[model samples]
Structures are given as C-alpha cells and as structure tokens.
Target chain A: MLKIEGLTAEIDGKQILKGLDLEVPAGEVHAIMGPNGAGKSTLSYVLSGREGYEITGGSVTFHGKDLLAMEPEERAASGLFLAFQYPVELPGVGNATFLRTALNAIRRQRGEPELDAMQFLKLARSRMKELSMPEDMLKRGVNVGFSGGEKKRNEVLQMALLNPSLAILDETDSGLDIDALKIVSEGVNALRGPGFSALVITHYQRLLNYIVPDRVHVLVNGRIAKSGGKELALELEAHGYAEVAA
Target chain B: MNAMTSNAEAFLRRAEALATPAWVGALRRQGVEALARSGLPNRRVEAYRYTDLTPVARAEFGAAPKALARPELPAQRGRARMVFVDGVLRADLSTLPPRPLSDAAPLLGTVENSATAPVAALNAALAEDGMFLDIPAGENAGLIELVSIVTEGAGPIAFHPRHVVRLGEGASVTILETCEGPDGVGYLHNPVFEVVVAEGATCAHTRIQREGQGAYFLSSIHARIAAGGTYDNFTLNAGAKLARNEIHSALEGPKAACHMNGAQLVGQGQLADTTTFLHHAAPDCASRQTYKSVLTGNGRGVFQGKILVAQVAQRTDGYQMNQALLLSEDAEMDAKPQLEIYADDVKCSHGATIGALDENQLFYLRSRGIPEKAARAMLVQAFLTEAVDGVADETCRAALDEAVMGWWQGVAA
Candidate 1:
C-alpha cells in the first residue's frame, strides 16, 4: 500500500535519491539493499517527512493518500512508522511515558479515545514481556544508557504497541547482534498480516534470513537499479553490491 | 539624575514610615546608605555587568501592601508551612509544630545575627511576620514549607522572608519554598532567605518562582554548612517581568558538601537571572553547580556563577556548569562561569555554553511522527531535566517538573 514514483531528493544541495520508483502492496514485506551513499536511508527519511531535505521532484502515496503532503505526526497518525537506525536517547522522558504520549497523540488524531495511565501501563508491561525487555527499562529514560540491542528491541516494542499499517525499518539490523537481529526480525514477522505492509532497508542480507521479504529492490546511486525475488537478497550476500551495480 | 537617586529616596521614605524594631530600622538605613554610596550597580561592577538592574532602579517603587490571605496548599501534603504575603509574614495564616523547640531555641533567637545585606536588611526592616524552624541535634525527618504570595497592587512591591534553618548534628530536613501571586494588579516581590546546616546534618532546600507576568521578582538565598554537613538547593523560575535568584553558600568545615541546581524558562520580554557564588572555605569540601536556561521570543536569561577556594581549603573539589538554549532569533542568553582557586591542591572547574536546539536531535524526534512543536518542546524539557532530577526530594522534584512543563506550555502557546 505504498508507492514512490520518480522520488528525486537532495540534502544540502547534493542529490541523493534521483528518480527512484518503487511500490509495496498490502500484506507484503519489501527489502531495499544498497551500499554506502546509495540513498537507502534517504528514502526512509524522505518518506518519514523529515525537514531539511529538498524533494527536488517526485511523489509518494500511502494507502491511497498523498504521503508527501502529510506532516510527520500526520503520517504517524495515518499508520506510518519509522524505526530509526540510531535510536535517540531522551534523558528525562521515560520510555513508557514517551510511548503513551505518542500513542495518545496518534489515537487522538484518529479520533480514538486516549488510554489512561493505568490502562497504558498494563498494555505496555505485557508488550515489554513479549519483547524480553526488563520492566525497569520502562521506568528509565528512553534509550538512555541502553545497550545497542536494547535500543533496537525498544523500537520493536514500540512497533508492537503502535501497530502501524506501514512500517519502515531503516537499518534496524545495524549494530544489533545475531540474537537481537533475530528478535527484532521475529517481532516484525509476528506483525505481518493482510492489513500490514513493511519496507525494510539494510546493507546485508543476514536480516532477510529471519524476516524474509516478498520482493527485493537494490538501490544504487540514488535509484532502484535492480528488482528481484527473495532469492535476490541471498545472491547479493554472496556476490556483494559491486556486481549488481556494475 | 540617575534612577537610583529617586528610587533610593523613595525606599528610605517608605522605610521611615514603617514602625520597625530600632535595630531593624537601622539596618534599613544602612541599606539606603549603601545604595547612596554605590548607586544601583552598573556594568562596571563585575556581578552586575551582564544583568543591568537600571531599568528596575528607574521605576518608582512603594511599600508592599499588608499581608493577604494565605494560599491553600493543594491536597498534596508536605512537612511544614510558612506563609508570606506581599513581603511580610502572616503568622495568622501560617501553621507550625505546637511544642516549643528544645534542641534549638525559637527562630527569634538567631534573628539578630542575620546579616544586613541591602536586600536582607530591607526585608528585615519591613517584614511583618515569618517562620523560623530548628531541627534539634540528631532529630529525624524534619520538613518545612515556605509559601510566598503577592495579593495586592502597591506600585513595585518587595517582600523579604527570612528563614533560619539550624539543623543540629546529624539531623535531616527538606524545605520547599513556593512563590505565587494572586491575579491582582501587577507588583514586585523581593525575598531573602538564609539556611544553616550544623555538623553531620543534611538540608534539602527547593525554591519555586511562579509569580504573575506583570510582577518583578528577586530572591536571594544564603546558606552556611559545617563539617560533614550537606546542602542541596534547587530553584525553578517561571514567571515575572524581571526575576533574579541569587544563591551564595559557604562550606565552613572539612568534608562539607553543597549541590546547587536550577532551571529557568523565560518568554516574551521576560527577564530571568540566576546568579550563584560558592565558597570553599575549609579543606576537603565538595561543591557542584548546574543550571540550565531556556529563552523564547524576546526573552532574556542571565547566568553568573563563580566558585572560590581559599588557600587553606586544600583538597577542595568544585565543579560548575551553565547552559542555555535560545529558542528564537530574538531570544538572548548571557552565561558567565568563573573559578578562583588559591590552593594548588584544590580541584575547581567551570563551563558555560549557549546554543540553539540540536538539529540532529530535532530531526530524530520529528521523524518518529511527533509534531515539530511537541518534538522541540520535548528536547528543551529534556535539556533541563537533569538539573530538576537532581533534587533529592521526590515531591519537590514533581512540583518543579510540573512548573517547568507549565512554563513550556505557556511560552510555546
């Protein structure tokens, strides 16, 4: 349920995503593989509506709506979620409190009743258990002093709670160990359903082994240079991006 | 021809009208004389260089109105209550422990020894009533609350509420001082407080300044700690046309400790200043000071802090840091942190930083679907949270945190 056509984007006057076109239909998981400076992360940032990026040209549609026109919070309310590669550390905002505020903000935007503190606590505690995160983490500041793996797991925990219609994982596998990668992948795989869609961006194919993709797109030099099946990820892991880009 | 000339004369005339104790009146005269000798401190004066009180000096000021009804404490309970209306104490509206103090005499016993500083003397000369608490030697669980409120309009009003907290050996106590104002005509509030911690004692003091926007507020806190004593002070300044909080502490004995932390948010023409001076007078004393200021619109913030160590104060450890975040192009912040150490064995350092919101941090939060305003507010709050979190008392911490959030909402709106 996501479409990107001629998505040309530049940051600081330097073009990163030049005329990139890709689509992920409902219920499918898409993986974008690329090397350094290939604009894989740029697509995720642009899709998330971050400021400072000049969208030179192109349009993005999510669930039949103009994704490029919506504000970041509007995109979030409309069921678009981005799992940042390097999770930010909010020193004074508790993890659970932050999640609750975000959840209510989105819910309010959707015209749903906000969850009370007690209600949120119960729901969050249960979800934390599912992700193997300690109850103490919920009380601490978001991602502050957390291990890299813990931060990644915290992201998945948020994904579980938000249950967005479309999820964008920008190198969620980076800095994560094999165990963390599996846990994160499993968390994503568990949310896969007919109503959900995902665009997973990564440099290596190791993560795909856990969360297999329905389609593979190789982004090179700011555009999607190759499109193939799930096997394409395995082939790249063996041969690397030089062969594909060349 | 200077503003201080007429202002000082007006202050003296008002001081003459009050039927103060002879000694108290004499103290006020000394303050007036000091003002005459050193007309409102100018840029040449090191401490007043960044913060010019000339504007306040130029304004015609009159005596504060009589005491008003005490403010009702929200259901939230604390240790003790001391009420001040205008700049005078309203004992009728205050509550204190019934039994007479045995460990330390009533506060009146120590009143005469209090200093005659310009602000302190002015408060003492005009103050009608106030609370004095003493924690007996080895006493446990002592708590005090000072509630200061402005009720009426009487030109520029100033209130000086003196607090002498004497913690006996090994005693502990927490003091919460909240400054508020009624929705009356705008006025001024200047309060002075003093705290003393005895050997092996611990004192936690918190000050919350939430005066009305039209009010001019100034507060000064002076503390002295003995050997092995600990003093912790936290201040939150949210309201006022011009608000200044000054904290001065002296570590008098070996191993005495002091922690000073404050957060201030000023918006739209508001001026808030936090000036602190910490003296390490004895060997092996440790002191730390951290302050954060957030300014928006044409708001201005000033932070001036200094750490001083004496030659005999060998092995002293002192650290001071001040940071400011300017939220708007028009917003301005002045930060100066100074360190003067005479003992080669002393360890003292100071740092000051002025910056705008971190772009990377902003983008990181906004990308998560949080609104730009909400994201910026979150980051700003986070920046100040460290100082607030350092408060030892949870209730006080929660109250200060709420005050911070309230200020943010008001300014952000």
Candidate 2:
C-alpha cells in the first residue's frame, strides 16, 4: 500500500533522510525503531507532505499515486494520516468542531455527503465513550490545556474517526502513561484488518509489545541499517542500537 | 490652521443660530475655540500620529439631513430611540421615556462644568436633541438599543446624539448603541454617549459601527460607575472610511468593576481606531480591557488604551491586553497600552502583540485536508472570536460575529 525509494530529505539545508527506502503492504503493521536522531519524525513529516522540507531526491508512491507531488491536504484526502507526537493547541476552535471540519473535508474529497451538526455530535459522542474520553473535552478548544496522555488519546481518537487507509504513528507512545499506551494500542489493534496499514515509529520496544508489529526496522542517522521480525525489537531493547548499527 | 479659519467660523455661525440653553451654548463656543486653536489634530500629535485627518478636515461640512421616511427597523425596537442627521438631532423621529424630572434627574445634570474635549464641547454646544433614560431605583431592563442612522448627500454631515443613561441604586440594563448609514452615501457621523451607573447598579453598553465605506465616523462613550456598580462594554467596528471609538470609564466607588472589550475588522484601505481610558478612583475597584484588530489589504488599525489608578484606589486590580493580526504585508497596526497608577497596593499589567497568521497552525490545518485559504480564514476568525465573545448580549454578539465573517469574505475575495 505504501513504498518509498531513495528518499533524500533535508531541513534547513541539513540532510535528515538520506537515501531511505521502506515498504508496507496492506493488512500489516511495520515498526521503525531508531536512535535519538534516526530521522523517524522526519520520515513521517515527509510522508505527510509538511512544507519547509526539501525533498532533493526521492520517490514516494501510495496506492500507485505519486505522494511526493500532492499537497498535505491532498495526501490526507487520499487517506494518509499522521498522529503527531505533540498535538498543537488551537485556541477558540472547539475540539469537536475541528474534528467535524476535518471529517467533512475528507468526506467531500471522497464524494461523500457531509454530516450535519447533529449527526456529527452523535457519532463523536459515541466514539468518545468507546475511547474513554470525557465529553467535556469536546467542548473546549482543540488540545488546549490537555494533558500529555489526553493529547495522545485524542490523536488516536481522530485516527479512528478519520479511518484513514494508511496511518503513520509518530512517537505516539513517548509521553503516554501505561494505561494510555494500552488504550491507544487497543484502539489501533481493533482497526487491524485487511486494507489497513500503519507505520509505527518509536524510540523503545515497549509499544511493540502491545501492537506486535509484523516487521521491525532500525533507523540510525537517517537510514534504516537493519531489519528483522518481532524478536529484533526485543534484541535492540536488550542490547541497544549502538552495537546493532555497528 | 488654514483649514480651521473658514471652517471654524462657519461652524460658530451655525452654532450661534441654535436656541440651546445658555450654558450649553457657552460650552459649544469653548469647544469651537479649542478646536480652532488645535486646528484638526495632525500627525505631529502622538495620539493621531498614525491616523491623518486631512481627508476629513478638507471635506466641506453641511447641515444635518432630514429624518428618513422609513419605519423604525425591528432591530431598533425597545429602549428609547434617538435620531440624528448631519450633526443635528431629528426630534420628530425620537421617543423619550416618560419620567419625573425632579425624582429622576440626570446623574451629571447636563455638563455644568466647562469641557476640555473640543469635539465633545462642539457636540454639546451645537446640540440638537438627545435621550435621557433614568432607570428607576432597584429596576432591571433587559436591553436598550440606541440606533444612530446617518443619511446625507456628498457633503460631510456631523451629528452629536447625546445619551444620558442614569441607573438608580441596584438597577441593571444592557444598552446597545449601533451606528449605521444608507448604502453608497458618503458622510460623517460624530456622536457622544454619556452613562452613569449608581450604587449597586450594573450596565452593559455595546456599540456596533457598520456604516457605509464612504462614511467617516467618530464616536465617544464616557461612562461613570459608582460604588458597587459594574460596567461591561464591547465595541465592534467593521465599516466606514475612517472610524474612531473612545471609551472612558471611571470606577468611583469601592468594589466597583469595569470590563472594556472591543474588536475592529478593517479591509481595503479602511481605517479604524479604538481608544479606551479606565480610571479607578475608589479602593478595591477592578478593571480589565482587551482589544483585538484584524487588518487586510492596505487597511490600518489603531488601539490606544490606558488604565489609571488614583492614590486612594488601594487594592485595585487592572489588566489590559491588545492584539492585532495583519493579513497582508501592506496592512498596518498601531497599538499602545499604558498604565498610570498612583496607588501603592494595586495590581496592574498591560501587554500588546502584533503579528501575521501562525504558520504552524496553518500547516496543521492544511494537513487535515483543509484548503490553505480556508484554514487562514478560520484562524483569523478564531482570533476575533475572543473579543466578540466578551459581549454580554447573545443576539448582539451573534450579529457582530456575522459582521466580522462578512468582512472576512469581502477582504479575502
């Protein structure tokens, strides 16, 4: 469902993703583990089509379409989702309202009828209950004054509502408590089926124990140096990436 | 100085013909003389540095227009109605609430002292007709709407519609002052509103300015709140070639509170200014002020606010904030927030910020499948919602919200 070949990206004229290649077929989850400066976040940003990153030499294809040429919104419309590590606080834009706008924008692009306020409220309320999120959060500004764990859960909640074909989880487990991690993992696992794919990026092997990725790849200095199965995550966790990359 | 010679003389001559009370006439002469000496504030004056009055000063002044023949609008219902045309009151179109003068006398009792404000003096001197609303002691009126409609031809027209609202002890009311004009007309509207809230009284005064683009509007609302009284006001400016709104409030009694909030949306070379002065005179009074402006194209916005705490006003709490968003590089914003406190045990603070849209927020919205322009518009709207929500009246707040959105549409297009 997704493929990246020779992806060379730089930020502020400093190279980050140098000649990177990755592939994730449908109905599977691929885990990308790396050291602190492994360009894990950069890969997600590039794939999500964020600006200010110069893609000097690379090709990213999603579902047979050139993802590199599309705008961020176009990528989202084409079913690409990024769960940010730090969700931005948009004051005065209600949480529910923001979600509804995003949902409808994607729906409009897919030639689906937009949901009205009542219908959206119903759908959102039910989802909030399932995710164990408080209803009051929907009334407040988007991510404003939210706890770290709450922000992660809110991101997952959005992914569930958006139901994107391919999801990129960038440090979703970094600031989460054990309970929040479990809840987020459960949420992702529930959506695991045919036609669903995800690139789970993390700094540790903790999240992998819950989601249990089908493949593990270690990224160091902007390039994936090693690849293996689920046991590789545990191996790296026990021995560390310093020896593995060497 | 050259423009003031002939213009001042003509205005004085017109004022001499009015049959105003002797005291009021003298005040008018004083104002005209002061204006003559000042000669239409220029850029040399720090307060008017960013705003030039050359265009307004050069326009020839004319007599107030006759009252329009249309029925009163539904929005103008309730509250006393005062109409002005070309700097004069159209008494035929106004309705005064019945009252006992001896029992329900005005709080200030008609400007007995000489005035320092030239324009206010001029308004009071050549005054036409005004409304006096005296809320009986311990009474509450939901909302009072004051509609100031300007209808003039090519020449400049000025009107001073004086409003004296006195809230008796424990009385409450919300006053909405709206300034509007006929479409496609070029005119000037100068209005003054004075309010007094008595002990334990509460008053919320809101002003909406949506005049014709060719119109030059200047308005001043001077309010005085007594001990234990509360005053909340919000002003929205969206129309006019150049518009200025000045609000001055004095908390004279202990435990009094005042909240002054305003928002101005300018587009396509438009100019709008919101100036506010808050004074704490008694111990334990509190005051807060917030003003936000959104400018697009070559539009310009100005905000000047000051909070003053007197020596006896101990334990005073005052806060003021002003923020501006410039949608285009050509757009300009001038903000000045000042505080003057003579009391030792007072807490006072002020802050000002001016910038373009947030790029990070823009990217976040765009990445969610929202178009760039729509995302920018949403952010701008959110910036304005802060000040608009400060208005206490729901209907009036909604109306201002719609007006801001409409202005955004015109500017974005």
| Highest lDDT model number | 2
What TM-score does candidate 2 get on C-alpha atoms? Answer: 0.93
User: Candidate 2, overall lDDT?
Assistant: 0.80
Q: What tens digits encode model 1's per-residue C-alpha lDDT throughout B1-110?
A: 25444545555566567666543445455555555545555565677777666665566665655535444555434765766666666567667652322222233324
lDDT by residue for model 2 (B1-413), tens: 55444534555566678766543554556666765655555576666777766566666667654544443444454456655444444566656453332232233224322233544554554555565677888999877777776653525566655566788999998877777776555576766667788999999887788888888786667788899999898888888989877787889899999999988988876899887888899999989888899888899999989888999999999999999999899999998888888999999989999999988888888778887888898899889888888887886787778778777888788
Best by DockQ: 2
* Worst lDDT 10-window in candidate 1 chain B: B100-109
Q: State the lDDT of candidate 2 residue by residue for A25-143, as single tens digits.
A: 99889999998888999999999988889999979999999999998988999999999988888997889888999999999988999999999999998888878999999999989
Q: By summed lDDT, which 10 consecutive residues of candidate 2 chain A come out lowest? A: A123-132
Candidate 1 residue runs with Cα over 4 Å from true position: B1-7, B16-20, B64-76, B97-130, B153-155, B182-186
lDDT digits (tens) for residues A73-183 of candidate 1: 889889999998988888877788788878887888888999999999999999888788899998999899999999999999988888899999999999999988888
Clashes of 2: 6
Cα-based TM-score, every candidate: 0.91, 0.93
lDDT of 2 at B183: 55
TM-score of each model's B chain? Answer: 0.90, 0.89
